[model samples]
Target: MDLNLRKAILSNISENDHKQLEATIVDAIQDGEEKMLPGLGVLFELIWEQSDDQDKQEMIKSLEQGVQQANTGS
Candidate 1:
């Protein structure tokens, strides 16, 4: 079978409103199953693609800080 995971994931929630999207994200995150990662990645990819340079930089900085905090058990 030919399967495009990203395509499937995007299509699944393409019509979501902002609150629906937020609920999806929060639910997936709270569930914390490995399978949810790819869906989150796809959503993040959409965000990154739409973001400007400054926004991208801010995301990178936040991610960096998050990683550092995780590593330190903070």
Candidate 2:
């Protein structure tokens, strides 16, 4: 099977308002299902592509901190 998940997800949600987008992301995270990961990855890819270098650096730093915290269970 050949499916363009990112393209399909983007197409489906492109017209969603800000609140709807926020709700979708929050729900996906709160649900804690493995299946939602690819959607989150697609969203992250979109954000990474659009972000400036400084913003990207900040995001990386935040992610590193999150990883560190998770590992330390803090």
Candidate 3:
């Protein structure tokens, strides 16, 4: 069986407007379930594809800070 998670996730949300998309992301994060990670990764892939170099750098910096904070148990 072939499961195309990314395609499925993208198709499910393809018609979402800005506010709906924001709500979807917030809901997924707040749920904190392992199953939601793939959906989040798909969303992040969309963001990465659309981002400019500066935006990508900023995202990397923010992610680095988040990882550091998590490591410190803060």
Candidate 4:
């Protein structure tokens, strides 16, 4: 995940939950090294479940903008 996505997620979650989620994500990332696609799917599901609709939309928009910037830069 990009910094923007991580920032958005952290912004929305409570401090306590954020720490727990961070640990969970770190563990998942380590596990994901052996199974990348599945690990990514799990990460997405975890983020999506914790996020509200507005945050989801914001993340999508941020990603879209990033793609556009990259395309234009190229």
Tell me each candidate's TM-score.
0.97, 0.94, 0.97, 0.44
Report the poorest 10 consecutive residues by lDDT, candidate 4.
Answer: 5-14
Report lDDT (Cα) of residue 8, candidate 2.
89
Worst 10 residues of 1 by lDDT: 27-36
Write the residue-wise lDDT of candidate 3 on 15-68 in tens digits.
999999999999999999999999999999999999999999999999999999
Minimum summed lDDT over a 10-residue window in model 3 is located at 3-12
**lDDT-superior candidate, 1 or 2:** 1
Q: Please give the distance, in angstroms, between residue 51's alpha carbon in candidate 3 and its true position after superposition.
A: 0.3
Pairwise lDDT winner, candidates 2 and 4: 2
lDDT of 1 by residue, 1-74 (tens): 99999999999998999999999899999999999999999999999999999999999999999999999999
Instruction: Estimate, for each residue in 1-74, the C-alpha lDDT of model 2 and write its tens digit.
Output: 99999898999789999899899899999999999999899889989999999999999999999999999999
Q: lDDT values of the candidates?
A: 0.97, 0.94, 0.96, 0.69
Write down the TM-score for model 2: 0.94
For lDDT, candidate 2 versus 3, the one ahead is: 3
